[model samples]
Target chain A: MTSSLVLGLELAYWQQSILRSLGILLAVLLPAGTFVYLFLFKMVSFMQSRLGPMEAGPFGSMQLLAEVGKWIQKEDIIPEKADRLLFKIAPYLVVSTVLLTYIVVPFGPDMIFANHDTGIFFALAVSSISTLGVLAAGWASANKFSLMGGLRAAGQLIAYELPLILAVVGVVIQAGTMNMSGIVAAQANGEIFGFDGIGSPYFITQFLGFVIFMIAVQAELAQTPFDMPIAESELVTGYLTEYSGIRFLLFFIGEFAAVGAFGAIAATLFMGGWAVPAAWADLNNNIFNLLGPLILMAKMTLVGGFIFFIRFTMPRFREDQLQKLAWTVLIPLSLVNILATTILKVAF
Target chain B: MSEFLRDYLTVAIFAAVAIGLLLVVLALGKLIRPVRPQADKYLTYESGVDAVGTAWDQTPVRYYVFALLFVLFDVEAVFIFPWAIQLETYGWFGAIEMSVFIVILALGLLYAWRKKVLQWL
Candidate 1:
């Protein structure tokens, strides 16, 4: 019996090491592929009233693959006057931020890579680094449009970032914890608006914050309705105007991946990551350990789809209009949300 | 490794690997892609105007005022977060203090508005 127990412990150790490696790999690579189709081709095409990528794989699933192939064959161009070093490194910097964010994402109750005490803050701080990368791309491109686009991105991101972080502060205050899993657990136990049966998701209690967070995230991602930074009509894809081939592809991947990352974070914060309702508590069995990510993905898809819906349906905001919304509207509303959440928490 | 270092190490590793993967994919693209740079193609695009003078000319962009304002409010926003995390512990005292803080900032915003600093010409 003792020998068998030792063998079991030995196996468990190896299994854990293997799982750690796999988790890191998935966190880094999966976001790049998971939503490429939904966000890139289908959603946009549907809004424009056409079949997207009908000729590629089954239901055009392979369309992205075909496009990647085509992009690879295209020439990598560098404008003669462009700053070569920054131009090359800018896209990578953005990618680095997106990847680092996954480390703290709580995929399940126990399925997080790192449940740092500063989880939400860590994600927010890392995401801000991408703005610097964007500014670098614009400065290095040596083009008027690129320069304008870069400055616009910097301003928009900085403005929207406030509301985004503040909105989460509501949820963070409610949960009374900064760790990602702790936030989820709080939601799982929470009741919505004092309703006994209704499971608490911050989406209901923090509705104002939710709306503001979603809007701010949309702007932060540079999607439609807030895409002044890359306004093709005015800026010709903005900071991306000078890039071609694989460099352009890097930016594309980073953007779509960011959409997924933000979706994941929002779902974790507002929708209650990996939490089933109390009524269905029995369903939260050992199987949840396996399906936890799937639950998170389902929530993420809903959040991301809402974002894409807004992106495709809404008109782009002008540069000044975008700044005004972030500063005058979102900032004030989020502050009010914090004040309200504080009073409510203190009273009840 | 300690849990703290391990967590951060994973983050660093994830970043390195992600950048590396992109580099490999781009490298693969470079291997098969053709490179033909013509003189015209090298010129910066300026709506087909044969690219006039350099693109570095200075123009009036009035948004910098708002940019400074953003810095002020953003710093204020940051201060609210830590206070928010410890809010319940501090109770009503914290609440009243934060209200006064926000009221002061709101006045700053009001001043800026009256001065028309927020107007995007």
Candidate 2:
């Protein structure tokens, strides 16, 4: 078996695989748990002027665990008319897609699970798979609300997906590579018109793309303002209307985990990713492999905070308004951004 | 296997591991959770009222139109990625070529907008 070095230890391929599997679990669940506790539990409560869950383990820190225990003991219900097979499989597909997206994100210099040439592209592609799961859950449930939620989610996801991809095109043009690590390296080594004090993170050069990407991400995650899919007031949690117990828990985890995954991707593309600026540290130092995950988590928290903040503050958009924003406003603007980026990239 | 294939293999393994973990939790839940097969419990939820018509009714045609537009732009996105990575090499020649491509797609979006197809209702 082939061997690879991790933390200065040589290990066999199988051992490395086991370690990586554990890492994937952490990468997905840790961020999900953190976001749920920090944003969903505490931040939202504070925003609403409440103390939040102070009873559960030191200021409601253990509320998530308590919620999980409550969910596990609840009955797993399948409606009589529901397609049992598809209903059972939907959450698996949704959660697994979120897990798969983390593979392409680089934590440290050598901390990536997969270093594909088309890393960011792979991440984008796998994320859209959740749309299928949403649609399936909607259709399989055989409920009017689920069906409406499913179709709305499908239309919304695909519409916002264009802007998301187009927004990344600007990043790809600036970084000159779709590889996530390569993009981070470019930012680390870059200078702002010969000023090397702070590397030229793409967020400055590609600010329009950054804005469009975040907006698209907001819609893609179906958070408020663009959350027509699961507009709880209207659609009764939308495609998730019929799910109960563990299945609902799976979807809940998938939603927050996706927020983390996309937040990490956004940080990688626009916020200089896992690297400190060249002025601060040498890019080649092996210490990054250790510090990188921590750096990424911090950045992810910033981006996730921004996402959830908007989610809490903003009112939901009407269906027509949501579609109009993606198709008319975001898409055309992203296309123009791409054109301008390409011109400047070639000119300078 | 080649290094390229090995990277993909890791992805496949990770996918399996995710599903496996979920399944383990699910099985444990099944062991603990109660399942009383009540008839009304299995009926679809409709805000505490009986469901009306079947949910398999036809949806609006606007959805299909949006799907078609998505396919068109998705292809454009695919084409743009390769050109993006190699833009430094392609220079103005590549820039002009991609410019023409993006303009055409934008025009299509404009056409959709003018036709009111972009509108949800």
Predicted structure with the largest DockQ when compared to the true one: 2
User: Tens digits of per-residue lDDT for model 1 on A1-348?
Assistant: 112234356444334434464556565456557577876588888888888877897889888889889888999898898889999999999877876787788776567877788899899999989989999999899888898999889888878988898899899889988888888888887886677465788998899999999999999999999888899998888999989888898888788878888998999999988777555675347777677788888998888888888888898877778877877888888888988898888777
Evaluated on the second chain alone, the candidates' TM-scores are 0.91, 0.94
The DockQ score of candidate 1 comes to 0.53
- Report residue A338 deviation for candidate 2 (angstroms): 0.6
The C-alpha RMSD in Å for every predicted model, in order, reads 3.5, 1.5
Candidate 1 differs from the real structure by a C-alpha RMSD in angstroms, to one decimal, of 3.5
> Cα miss at A206, model 1 (Å)?
0.2
For this target, which candidate reaches the highest lDDT against the unseen true structure? Answer: 2
All DockQ scores: 0.53, 0.84
Q: What CAPRI-style quality would you assign to candidate 2?
A: high
Worst 10 residues of 2 chain A by lDDT: A14-23
Per-residue lDDT over A13-102 for candidate 2, one digit per residue giving the tens place of the 0 to 100 score: 767876788777976798889999999999999999999999889888999999999999999899999999999999999999988999
